[model samples]
Target: MLRWRPWLPPLLPLLSLLTLLVLSDLTSSSPTAAPTETGAGWSPPAPVNHLTCYFCENVENNYICNRFAIDHPCPAGTTFCRTLHIMDTRGGSVVVNKHCATEDQCRDDRVGCLQQDHQKTCVSCCHSSYCNEPVPTNYSNAVRQPKPTAPTRAVKSAGAAAAPRLLLLLAAAASRLLLLLAAAASRQLLSGSRQL
Candidate 1:
């Protein structure tokens, strides 16, 4: 009587593939299903937590400004944009800073403004994503504009979306590697059996 044990080696790979597929399906569905069901009538809103601004800081007569300004995501509890202009007559230096701010920091339209001799400082705050894109070239003539207050609470961060994507990629690579190993092992077993 021929034993059935010889067939088990070839079946192991098929079984492993099915198991991985089932596990992937289960993991992918758990996190996304509830959100889709609850938001049936409402489409998800765009991510507005990220802020972009033009940032340049000059001190001691050093000047720096570029077109390739980067977008910086605010930390938790920071929802406003701020632009600061400072000028000092000591050496005729001007500094500009654009970055994320908090509700308290931006409470007043102007955070700081002082003029002494040729020294001056001007700060303006606004509550909108990318609102600080424009940098005031003329610190003495820049005007502060009123802006709406943003919500004080911090929203969900964008990094939450990256984890699942990474997991999926790793799963795909593992599945492919398992398949190749199984193929090689099966081929070796067939050759050995034929030689018996």
Candidate 2:
């Protein structure tokens, strides 16, 4: 002989709903995952700090620049220190310009030393503090352009990306199943109550 519990029928639907909610929460992606993790395509924001550089302009010679260069802090968004050396072959004269430079400016002018008949120009860029203090007089020893920044977002692999979608789909399906079960359980409880 078996005894039917009157309260269990209604409670079954509530329990199933609770279980589905918990499962959905557990399967969801973490909110802070992108910021905390350094994946293949994810990079942290660049740190903002005072960047010091050797600053001068049209100093005419490397030795003069070395003696007269001022240590100055670069403005916001200007990361590299630059030195532009210009040599006039026919005139036997050298002109130097040193200043704080942005990455774009460095990239645009980093063609090394190019000679056009009687004149040669070279641009050097560096990131360390006072890196432009020792200006290069010629093309052979000039610094190359600074490297570009890392990408802002992470690239997802096929399987790794598919996993979250699969979990979401499973959760959605489970929710529907739980709702159907609740509907059936409610109907059974209503019939039982009506009979009583």
TM-score of each: 0.41, 0.45
Clashing pairs in 1: none
lDDT, candidates in the order shown: 0.61, 0.71
Q: Pick the candidate with the highest TM-score.
A: 2
Superposed on all Cα atoms, model 1 deviates from the true structure by an RMSD in Å of 10.9
Highest lDDT, which number?
2
lDDT of 2 by residue, 8-95 (tens): 6667768677768767676755443345364555455555656787777888887788788886678889988888888888534478
**Candidate 1 has what TM-score?**
0.41
| Candidate 2 residue-wise lDDT at 1 | 22
lDDT of 2: 0.71
Q: In candidate 2, list every pair of residues with a backbone clash.
A: 41-153
